[model samples]
Target: MSIRIWGRPTSARTQKVLLALAELGLPFELTLASGTMGAHGHVAKGNEAFGVVDTPDYRAMNPNGTVPTILDDGFVLWESNAILQYLAMKYDPDRFYGSDIGRFASAARWIMWENNELIPPMHNLVKHTIRLPEDQRDPEIAAASRAALGRAWGIVDTQLSRTRHIASDSWSYGDIPMTIRVHRWALLAGVDALSPTLARYYAEVSARPSFDAIRDPAMHLAG
Candidate 1:
């Protein structure tokens, strides 16, 4: 199979796919598509990567012009969570993607929750704290975002009290997105400690070598 993925390694969404590939032990080509490496020698919107996203070639594949678009053989896929599910199903069906309907749906449910409930506040906190300049950063907004994220994680902590994993007794695709977000939240300054169960889960999941390989600190975007 021929697989080529385009996206900057720094993007958490892009990193999600990379971690899955590593877990699946799949070999694929990677072209920097939305970060410094993907900026086709032009800077736009104060972010060269964003410039790449607006390019005609990139837009042709993903109208959203977002990072983490995958070209698997001749098939094209976008949306990071979708990419993760597809890759898992194709490469490790009985494992990451799940072997039955119940497990598969559970994975999908958490992926959806990550996108809908968790990501917004996480993105806001990152934007106000690290992405924005000091003069532009709003403490109130950051604090509110952080508080919202804390509450979201609190729910996860409660869930962990009942099960060892997010969706099942064992690790599955459902853990990937939330693990990434939890780790991202932990990186922010002044963030509170995770609840014990949640903290233990984060420590275990984030320790996967697949995550360590693609999580480059230098890849962080300042925008």
Candidate 2:
């Protein structure tokens, strides 16, 4: 395989890359490097890399020791969203991503919004609510995340009400990360936590026959 991803399947970020690879029909290998390393299931489940990523060799490839690092046929890339762009641009640009400047910019915008805004609170909620042991769970953080998520998801919900997808009237690469994140969010936050529109949107997106590419039954929430 030309592409090898060093990460766990249950990782949200890694799943995004995996979905992209699946959508593109790209053959690859997964070098599990996080779970046994220290994922709270050892702390990361992304950053805790003892077994695989901590090795000097893995560090040489990914200095940060973060999961989801990709060695794509000799071109090394870290950061999941960046990897998504690389794959889309290289293999199926027009199909998943596009060369059009506006769409490109929009895709970049949504991906950044997901990483910078939505994910922080969403992951916090997940950590406190599910991933952490009952004794370790923090109700305060989970409540705060729920409140913050309302505002963040409101923006996306409004946009989705206006169109079928994030970057365009049709599905775009921009929707991939958001979809993955939203699936997790809904699982933890409950569909009622979302606006009627966003809830409906999630249902529709997940129900799509094409969603199989991104679907993982062992998804953290489902497990």
Q: Estimate each model's TM-score.
A: 0.88, 0.88
Candidate 1 lDDT, tens digit per residue, 157-205? 8878887788887788888887777676666542357777877887788
Give the clashing residue pairs of candidate 1, or none.
none
Q: CA lDDT, every prediction?
A: 0.76, 0.78
How many angstroms is residue 119 displaced in model 1 relative to the true structure, after the best TM-score fit? 1.0
